[model samples]
Target: MPETPPITKPRRRDLTLLGLAVLLAIGLVVVLVVRQGGSDPEASSSPASAMSAPSAAEASATAPIGPLGDLARRQADDPMALGSPTAPVVLIEFADFRCPFCAQFGRDTKPVLIDRYVNKGVLRIEWRDMPIFGPESMSAARAARAAAAQGRFWEFVTAVYDKAPARGRATLTTEALRGFAATAGVPDLARFDVDAASVDFDDAINADLQEAQSLGIPSTPAFSLNGEPVLGAQPTDVFTAMIDNLAAGGPANS
Candidate 1:
């Protein structure tokens, strides 16, 4: 018999089609993975996942009024505060004395707020010490509290911020603090010094710091204007608008 022809293997064209189909399948899988991971790969794996959700800074410039109402500790005798306890709106500030942004707010926006809203009895401002800048920050906070004990809190803070450098500097020394206290007119320097170094003052400062942390305030100069979270040292207009909106019984961001 004639030699039997060997069985023919698949044609190259057929092999090429199979390979193309496999490649197409892989491409589809890659597309699916990318879609699942989101467009920004870095954002998809951001460290915020480890924290308790997005902070006020990460949220809108002015958050809507909601659960943050609890942040208002409206003590009638809170000396480090301004305006009336019965004011229509309350603004809670979580700030660090050593934070330049906080100082900026103190120097620029705070005065406006005080003039337009605070003095008008339309708004109240509660101060919370969030000393995130180490020992000096804590010391400054304590000193301010000590000043508050003598009813000079606002004055002391204003003086300190007035003398604060354009950029952040380590200027809050014991002697410097005493000088600021003097400028604020704290009548009893000896008492102020003693109270500033007391455990009670430390605890008070810690309480404010813990409250800020719990509310997801990661930095200084964070504010809650009538329960609407406003982060950073925003423009004076931004604050006035929010205050005006709240005063009119409108929404926080309106």
Candidate 2:
């Protein structure tokens, strides 16, 4: 198997400073995102947990988000990524399988983006696993990677989120994840199970998680498109407008 790119980890002493800052932000994220990931009554239809993506005009008026562009790995063989590596606009998504809003984005807006942009060679999507809900969420992330090892990452994504509940975290236990693997057509079930049960993939997963934490990403389904932070499961038009702006040459990286 190809190696997962390593994210540079901070020195152990630096964690103190990082943790103190992440503590407050994560607390806010847990509270705000609980309304979207757990038993919140209004999670089904609201984008409340998200950070709010700007319209094309707003994006145009803002200063170029040059530094944020570094988040795009654009690794050609990265199994968790989609579309052309050289696409003009690259969208980085940080999400957890157990997050309802992530499910909503997977079920709704993502397909449109895939069809309208990804398929047309204008956009690339790179996924980062942020398993914030708990161990089950973490397990699901691992299981998804197991499928990725067999070249079924996107299929696993669709199976896991395609029929998930719109208002709460999905059931993502080992057994349930195995079922999802089946639905995703992972060619080697035994291998998938073993890999899912192993800790070998945690580094890549944690790297993605830490990157999101370092950025103070408030919740799941958050995105950075051509380096602009867009929090939430935004509307299709919002993403479309942004893509159009980028395609029209809004930023150097876009």
- As a whole number from 0 to 100, the lDDT of residue 209 in candidate 1 is 89
TM-score of each prediction: 0.73, 0.73
Predicted candidate 2 versus true structure: per-residue lDDT over 1-254, tens digit per residue = 99977545665557777888899999999998886566534445567523222232243333344556457666679999998866777789999999989988898899999999999978889999999999999999999999999999999999999878979888888899999999999999999999999999999999999999998897898998877888899887888888887877776433
Which RMSD does model 1 reach against the true structure? 11.9
RMSD of 2: 20.3
